[model samples]
Each structure stands twice: as C-alpha cells, then as structure tokens.
Target: MTSAPKPISAIDLFCGAGGLSLGLKQAGIEVAAGFDFDESCRFPYEANIGARFVHADIAEVTAEHLEEIWDGAETRLLAGCAPCQPFSSHRRGADTSEESNWSLLEHFGRLVNETKPEFVTMENVVRLMRMPVFEQFVQGLEELGYTVDYRTVNGPLFGLAQTRRRLILVASRQGEINVPKGLGNGPATTVRDIISGLPVLENGQSDPTDPLHRARSLSPLNLKRMRASKPGGTWRDWPEALLAACHRKPSGQSFQSFYSRMEWDRPAPTITTQAYNFGTGRFGHPDQDRSLTLREAAMLQGFPVDYQFVPTGSKPTLSKVGKLIGNAVPPAFGRAVGQTFIRALAQSIEQGEPT
Candidate 1:
C-alpha cells in the first residue's frame, strides 16, 4: 500500500474570507482555524474553507488560546496578511491619525513571539515598507532568532491576471529564508481571458440559477448615466446635461478620470471594494453596458469560476461581496507565498537552524 503524504498544518490570523487559507489548503496544508474580527466573514470562511472561524479581535486572543489549538503539532505555521488600508499609497498625503491598522502587525508579532511557531509568513501592500513600524517589525524578528526574507512581488508575474502588487515576508525560526522566483511574465492577461465566457447579463440583471452572478441594482439616473458611457471612455464622453455639477467646473475636470470605463483588450484596473461605482474607478465593463458584477470582480481576483465565498441563499450585494473579494489576498499570490514558506522551512530543517 502507498503511504499518505505528510500533513502540513497552519493557523491563519486576520483571515478575511479565508483567501490565504484556501490557497494554503490547495498546497496540501490543513488550516486548523482562522482568526478575525469580521463577523460577516464567519459564514463564508466556514462554509467555503471549512476552517474553524474565531470572530474575536486579535488584540484579545491569548497565547494560551493558540497553544491549546495547536495541540502539540510538530510543525506549526502562522500566517497573516495584516490590514493595509492605513498604510496604503492612497492614504499617503492624508492624515491617518485615527487609523488603528498600523498596530495590528505588532499584535501579530506579539502572538508569534509568544507562541513561537516554527514558521511565519505575512503579506501586505508595498507602501508599508516606508513605515517605521515595519522596520521595527523586521528588527523584532531578528531579535527572536528568525531568518527573514521580505520583498514586494507583482501578482501577474505569478500567473494572476490582475496587475496587483503586494509585499510578502517569510521568516523561519529554523534557518535562512528566500522568496521563490517568479514563474515569469509571459503574456499580459486581459479582461476577456478571465470573465469572457461567463453568462452575459444586462444592467440590473441576475443569473436566476446563480445568486453570486447577480449585478447590483442601478438607480434610474445612473442607468441613464452609464448608457452614455462607452468602454474606455470617460465622463467627458457623457452629454453635457448629464455631468455632475462639480464635474462641470474646471477644477472638477481633473477628477473626471475617476468615472471611466475599462478597455476591452487591456487588463482591468485594480478591483477595489467600491469598484461597483462606475464613476469611482475603471469599473465599467469593456464592451458591456454595466459595471463589473460581483462575479466578474471575484473572477478577476483569481478566484476559480466555481469558488464559493458567499452562502447559497445570501443576496450578492455589491458592497457585501466587494468587501469579501477586495479584502482577500488573491489565492494565486497566497499559493506562491505558501510554497516559499514551505521551502524555506525545509531548508532550515536540513541545515539545522534554531527550531
């Protein structure tokens, strides 16, 4: 009889919609539990990922709680992608005095230091490197005797169709660490490459059989607004009468680019939580008459066609599903990081480092 493969186990922190957990599972690791404060995530995280979802604030989770959950597992992997909203490039020129996201990484460090997992991995926006907190985070890992490797990587280089970039950091208690090479940027994946084959829907239409494919309802004024919009066109193309009052001024002309349509032959713009706002970003479909639906947005995020993040009976609203998709680390990127973490650990084990 053939022997079974060795089990790889992990615990995911700040697990939003279980994207990283799902990717790790794809690589043969079993996620024991996911910790997050979003109660809205509980249904999707549990239903789709099949991992125990703890809806507690991370600042309140104790080391004892983690130890009890590990249950003497030989090799424990701790993974997290801290909230990056406060440290994003968009927030650079603004005052973020009220943002609490910066401190979460420190909390992550505290938990890892106390629990002493054999391996660790983290992902975030590239702009985070500019923060003094990030520097201290790297120094803290070295103090704990971890061999760390951190770098920013583009998602499309790893076979993801989107042009999203993220900072990935992997550290091992055992030995040296390095990120894996990119699979190479061969072809630029276009919007058609991802969602082209899916069933087509008109504005405010829904696939009766697939709730997840439903498009958000449009207001009558907005319906008339989009009809005047063209793929790759801006509000400049709209009739003068339909333009927003502010957009009618010279100062507002600069912001006209915000409400634009996506080009058909090019890669879609970065999908954000408010991507359904046709005027908020390059969210309008290339050749279609509607903004990118929740299903299309999820697909562009590298989720498999049949991947289930929302429940069957749940209404797939733009705001709700957008938060779920937007907050998720693209599974393709997650898998790349997971493989690198595993390799770094294996190298450390062979060379006999700290763990």
Candidate 2:
C-alpha cells in the first residue's frame, strides 16, 4: 500500500470572505485559521471556509498563536493580501500617505519575522510595485533567508473571466518559489459565460424570493438614462435630455465608461464596490435593461455559483456585496499560486535545497 503525501497547512490574514482560503482548500491544503479585524466578516469566513476566524488586529497575533495552530503540520504557510486600495492605479497613486491603512503590508512583514513560517504568499494590485515599500518587503524577506519570486498576472488568462490584473508574491525558507505561468493565448472568457443563465429583472428589481440576488434601487432620472444606454454604448449615445449634469461638464466628458453597457462577448470591466449603478462604471448588462446584478459581480470575482456570502434578513445591497467581491482575490488565482508552491516544495524536497 502507498502512503498518503504529507499534509500542508496555512493561516490566512485579512481573509475577506475567505476567497484565498477557499482556493487553498480546493488545492488540498488545510487552512489553520483565518485572521481579520472585521467582526462582520467572522460569520461568513467561518461558515464558508470551515475554519476559525480570529476577529482581532493582526498586530495582536502572537507567535504562540501561529505555533498552536500549525502544530503537527509538515509544512506551514503564512498567507495574506493586504488591502490594495492604497496602491491601486485607479486612485492615481494617492495611497502613499502615511495613514494607518497604508501600513498593512508592514504588519504582514512583522508576522513573517516573528513566526518564521516555512512559506509566505501575498497578492495585490500591480501598482504596489510603484511604492518603495514593496522593495523594502522584498529585502526583508531576503534578509530572513527566503527565496522570493513575484510578478504581475492577468486573471482572465488563468480561468477567471474578469480582466483583473494582480501582483503575486511567494517566498519560502525551504527554496525558490516562482510565480504561476500564464496559460498563453487562450480565448478570454466573457460576461455571458459567467452570468448567462440567472433569472432576469428590471433596473430596480429583486428576486422577491432569493434576497441575495437583488439589485440596487435606481432613481427615476437614472432609469431613463440606463434605458437609453445600450450594450457597449457610451454617454455620447444617450439622449441629450437624459444626460447628467456631470456628463455635460468638460471635466466629466472624458469618462466614457460611466452609464455604459457591457459587451456580451467581452470580459467584464473590473467589478467595483458600486458596480450596480449604471452611472458608477461600466456595469450595465449587455442585453438587459439593468446594471450587473450582485450575483454577476460575485461570479466575475470567481466565486462558485452557490457560494453564500450574506445571511438572512441582511439585504444584499450592490454597494455591500460589490465591496466583498471586488475586495476578494479570485479563488482560481489562489489555486494557481498554491500549485506553484507545491512544485517548489517538491523540488526542495528532492534537491535538498532551502525553500
């Protein structure tokens, strides 16, 4: 009889909605715990991930906590993707202010230094490279004797239908860890592929039954504005009477994607926290009257069709659910990173090298 392979374990920090943990579980890794500061996230993280959620600041997490959870595991991984809004290009690099929110990455480094986990991984917007702090992070890992590899990746090329690009980093004390290779030149998945079959609704409609599948309310003026907008159509296509005051302004003239409809054949625009508003971004459905639904946004973020996010009585507003989906790392993207780590671990075991 053959023996089973050794088990792998990981602890996830900033584990919003448990996207990364779900992916790690898909890759056969046991999640030790999910750590986050948001008490609101605790129920969802624990319910979906089947792991403990530590609803405290990461700064309060001690080495003993990590050791206690990782006990009896052959390999330990410390994984996190610090909040990326501070480094996002959409915000035009204004996230450089020394605000408390900007220090999550530094906190991640502290956790690594204190616990000395065998493996470390992180994912964020590619714009993070523009900051000097990223270099400091790399140097800190190197100082701790870790072989680190990182690169920018396009999510659509790796099974996600959204045009999401991210910076992923993996480091190991056992040997070198490389970024997942892109599956070159395949056809991009489109909006229709992700949400073609769901029941349709109007601009301000809900399923009446499936509360989680509801759309945000639209104002009377906005409803007329959306009706005039067709798939892939811009504000230029809207009737003059329905145009918003900003649309007529010289400063707002350049923003074309607003109040625009999505193309059925094209990958979706980046899902944002306000994706249900036709005027917010390119969130309108290709052939439908309304903006993208909450379920559609979740699907584009690579959540499974049945993945439960919100609970009973709590209405799934576009802004709230969009924030959850937009903030999450796609599970497929995490699986790709996990596979890379698996290969690196195997190589280290074979060659007697440090990971």
Candidate 3:
C-alpha cells in the first residue's frame, strides 16, 4: 500500500486574527508561525491558531528568519495575503503611489526569491489584477522558475455567507498549480443561514452572554431610517422627510447601497472595516432594527462563531475589532486554498517527485 502523503508546513505573512491560519490548520497543514506588523493580531492569532506571532514589518523579515521558521521541513509553503487597501475599489480615484502598502507585493516577491520555498499562495482584492504592480509580481514569480496560476473567485460560491470576490494565486516549484474551483453550486449561503440564530439585541445593546454581539448606538434619525428600511432595499425606500441632504443630490443617487438592510435569502454585501456602522453599507440585519454586530460581521467573513477576537479583560473596540474581522481572508476561501496545496503535494508524492 502507498503511504500517506507527508504533511506540508506553512508560515502566514500578514496574518490577521488567524483567519487564514485557522483554515489552513483545519485543512491539515501545520502552520508553524504567522507574521504581521500589527501587535493587536498577536493575541487572537496565537490564542486561537496556536501559531507563534512575529510582530514585524515584512520588509524586515529576512530569509534567515524564514529558514528558522521552516526548520528543515520537507516541504515549505509561504502564504502571503498582503493588505489589499492599496488595490481596493475604495482607492480607485486616489493616488496609490505614496501608499506604503503598494510596495508590499513586490516585497513579498523578494521574500519568495530569497527563501526559494517549494510552494506559495497569495490572496488579494480582485481589483489588484488591474494594477501594473500585480503584473510585475506575477512576472517575478514566473522568472524565478515557479509555476503560477491565479484567478478571481466569488466568496459565496465557496460557502461563505458574504458576496465577496477575491483574487487567489498559487505557485509551486514542483509543477503547475491552480486554485480549486468553488463548491457553491446548489444554493448560496444566505444572511439568515448564519446570523438568524444569534440572540437579539436592541440598537447599542450588548448580549450579556457574548461580548462580541455588542452593537453600536445609532442616532435617532438613523434609527428611524433603519426601521423604514427593508431587506435588500435601499435608502431610496425611505420617506422624503428622512432622506439626507446628500441623497437629494444627483451624486447621492449613485450611493444607493448605503444604509440598506440585508436580505434574508440572499448573501450579504462584502463586509468592510466599518460594517458595524449602518451607514457604511447594507450591513443592517434583516429582522433586527440595528446594524450587524461585531460577531455577525466576523461570521459573514467565514470565521467560526466562537473564534476569539480579543482576550478576556480587554475591551472590544469597534474600530479595532472591525478592522481585524474585515481585513481577514474568509476562512472558507483559505480552506479551499489549503486543500489545493495539499492535493498538489499528494500528486507530487504519488508521481515520485519532490514538492
């Protein structure tokens, strides 16, 4: 009988709250460590995934550091989901050259060349494909003798409850590699599927049993606006009196998704760092008269309901926690990537080739 394939080890760069690491661990890859410049990520990353968190800028991480992290493993996988803000839709009209994040992808390419890992993966906003930097990064990987494949994917199609699209790239020194096709054919996961079972709370109320279920307070005008809102409906549905001055402007007509409620049967809009704020997007609950709570936002991101965001005794601030949850790679998508990597490794082993 053929022996089972040996396990592959990985290190996650830009790991945020261990979302990618958690999915990778569940998919049978041993996550040795995670590196990020944000110190806040250390708590949740180490606590939940048990991977040592290295708090340092990616530019400061040397090949020697990765060698130590790899520690002579037969297969080394480096995963980098660099921050996508520089390439996000939100930055469409802005000048991104001055942004420090614009250089992170190139920096990631440098690390890959320095370490020469056998396997690699990266995730980013779909908009990155439109940027020249992304092209350069891909070319750099190809020039280094790595076979690379990348594609844009819809998150809901991968069993996530949110309708987010991302670009995923997988590279291998062993042979050609590609991201696995999504498993979301029958019926897409809906807003009701994930958050309907959670306890109900009033606007600005916190669940006594769960700290993350706390909601932020809304102004009276916004409260009335939410009450007037319907699932899958836009702010346009509101009465003339409740409409904001901006909405009266022609430009405001273009921003119809803001302050809208999510539909129960449909997948939610892409959760953002400000999702807890009702005005950010269509983040309002279908039944509840308030915006989505921190926990709800995390769930939509494909994080387990029990995933710890902050340690006990530490206050959960919306800005901090929201950024962590929103910036995370949906664990479901990460799981798919991890499974693809495992399959590649298995294929190489079966063919009597090194990975």
Candidate 4:
C-alpha cells in the first residue's frame, strides 16, 4: 500500500493574533511558529493557536532561527504579510517617503532568499502593486529560482463578511504555482450574517458575559446623529444643524463613508483600527446608536466567535484589541490559501519532484 503524504509545516511572520495560523490549522497545515514584533499579540496568539509565538522584529530574524523553528520538516514554508500601511490607499497623497514599514518587504525578501523555503506566500493591500519595493521583492524571488504568481482578491468572495481587497502571492521552487480562484460560495456574507445573534446592548453598553463585546460610549450629540442615520445611508442624509464644518466644505463633501451605518444585507466596509469609533469610516451599527464592538469587528474579520483577544485580568482596550482584529488576515481566506499550498505540494510529490 502507498504511504500517506507527509504534512507540510509553516512559520508565519508578522502574525497578529494568529488569524492565519488558525485558518491554516483548520486546513490541515501544521503551523510550527508565529513571529511578530508586537508584544500585545503574545497573549491572544498563544491562547488560541497551537504555534509558539515569538515576540521579535522580523528584521532581526535569521534563517538559522527559522530552521530551528522548523525543526526537521523537509517541506519548509515561509509566509510573511509585512505591514502594508506605507502602500495603502490611505497614504495616496500623504508623504510616505520616510515610512518605517516601507523596507519590511525587502526584509521579507531577504529571509526568503536565505531560508530558501520550498513554498512561500504573502498577503498585502492591493495598493502594494503600485510600489517599486513590491517590484523589487518579486524580482528577488525570481532570481532565487522561484516561480511566482499573484492576484488581487476580494474578501467577501471567499466567505468573509468584510469587503476587503488584498493582493495574494504564491511562489514555488518546485514549479509554477497560482492562487486558487475563490470558491465564491452561496450568497455573499453580510453584516448581519456574523453579528446578528450576539447579545444586544444599548449604546455604550457592554455584555458582561463577553468583555470584547463592549462598545465605546458616544457623545450625546453623536448619539442623536446616529439615531437619525439609516443603514447604508451617509452623513449627507443628516440635517444641516448636525453637520460638521468640514462636511460643509467641498473637500469633505466627497467623504461619504464617514459616520455611516452599515447595511444589514451587504458586506461591511473594511474594518480598520478605528472601527470601534463611530466617526471613523462607516462603522456605525445598523439600527443601533453606536459603532461596532470589538467582538463584532473580530467576527467581521473571520475570527472565530470564541477567539481570545486579551488575557484574563487584562483590560480589553479598544485601541489595542481593534488593531489585532483590523490587521488580521481573514481566517477563511487563509484557509483557502493553505489548501492551495497543499495541492501544489501534493502535485510535486506525485511527480517525484521536490517542493
């Protein structure tokens, strides 16, 4: 009888709260370790995922360190989704010339070359395609003899409730590889699809049973504004008296997404670090007079309902927890990518080739 295929192992760099690790584990890949510079991530990442969490910057990580983490696995995989703020659409007109995170992609490329892993993957904002650093990273991979393929993907198409667009790249030393087309399952996930069943709370009220379900208290005037707002409607629909001075200006007239309530039937706008604040983006809840709670934001990001964001006795601050949720790769999308990696590896094994 033929032997079963050996399991592939991976190490995630810039792993925040272990979202990718969770999804990859669900897809049958063994995540050996996760490394990130954020110290706040240690509690949640270690609590929920099986991988060991290393609190160190990626630039300081060496191939020897990674090989030590990999232990003895022959099918080594290195995955990194470096911070993409420098290449995000939000920085379009701003001075991003000195952004500290700009060189992280280059650092990622260096590790890939040094480690010489058989399989590699990277996820970043779609705007990354426009940057010169992105070109250099791809060229570096090619020079290392990797066949790379990448494309922009919509999160909702792959079962995430948030409307996030990201660039996904896959590389293989064994042969050419491609990102799998999204499964495009049944109906698109909606805001209500994930958050409808959570316990209801008044504006600024938190469910005592779940600390992460706490919503920030809105100011009286903002409460009134939220009451007047309708699902999928913008601040433009509000009365003249409640409008901000900036909104009255021509420049602000185009910022329609601010102070807007999410429609129940459609996927939510991308969840950002400020998603818990009503004034940031279209974060207000439909029919509720407050923005999305931390738990709700995590749900929209495809994190499991029971996923731990902070340890016991540690206060669950919105800023700290929101960053973890907002920056995570949707677990569903990660699962799809993990499955694709497995297929590529299996194909190589069948042909008696190394991957």
Quantify all predictions' global Cα lDDT against the true fold. Answer: 0.78, 0.80, 0.88, 0.86
Compared with the true structure, the alpha-carbon lDDT of candidate 3 equals 0.88
TM-score of 1: 0.88
Q: Against the true structure, what is each candidate's TM-score? A: 0.88, 0.91, 0.95, 0.94
lDDT, residue 84, candidate 4? 70
Candidate 4 at 335: error in angstroms? 0.6
Give me the displacement of residue 244 in model 3, in angstroms. Answer: 0.8
Cα lDDT tens digits, model 2, 1-355, are 2234465789998898888988888877789899877666676788789999987676667788888888867888999888864332234244456343447787789889998888899998888877877888899999999999999988778878888888999999987778887677888888888888788887678877666566667788877777888787798887889888898889998999998889988888887777767778998888767777778888888888777777866776556567777788889887887777777677667676333
Clash pairs (backbone) in predicted model 2? 172-355, 173-355, 174-354, 174-355, 175-354, 175-355
Model 2, residue 154: distance off in Å is 1.3
Q: Which ten-residue region of model 3 has the weakest summed lDDT?
A: 85-94
Task: List, residue by residue over 1-355, the lDDT tens digit for candidate 1.
Answer: 2223245568899898888888888766778899887787888789878989998777778899888878888778889888875332233354555344577788888998898887888988888888878898889888899888889887778777777888988888767777655787588777888989888888888888777776666677777777888877788898888888878788888875566777766777777887777768878877667777777888888787777767777776678778889888888777877776666556655556443
lDDT of 3 by residue, 137-176 (tens): 8898899999999999998889998899899999998786
Pairs of residues at least 3 apart in sequence or in different chains that clash in candidate 3 = none
List candidate 4 stretches off by more than 4 Å: 85-100, 353-355
Error of 4 at 65 (Å): 0.4
> Residue 186 deviation, candidate 2, in Å?
1.1
> Which residues of candidate 3, in runs, are more than 4 Å off?
85-101, 353-355
lDDT of 4 by residue, 1-355 (tens): 2245688889999888888888888888889999888888898888999679998877678989999999889887888688875332333364558444467777789999898998898989888888888889899999999999999999888988888999999999978689867875779989989999999889989898899998799999899889989899999789989998889999998889898899999999999988999898999998778889999999999987899988876679889899889998888777988898888887777777433
Q: Of models 1 and 2, which has the larger lDDT? A: 2
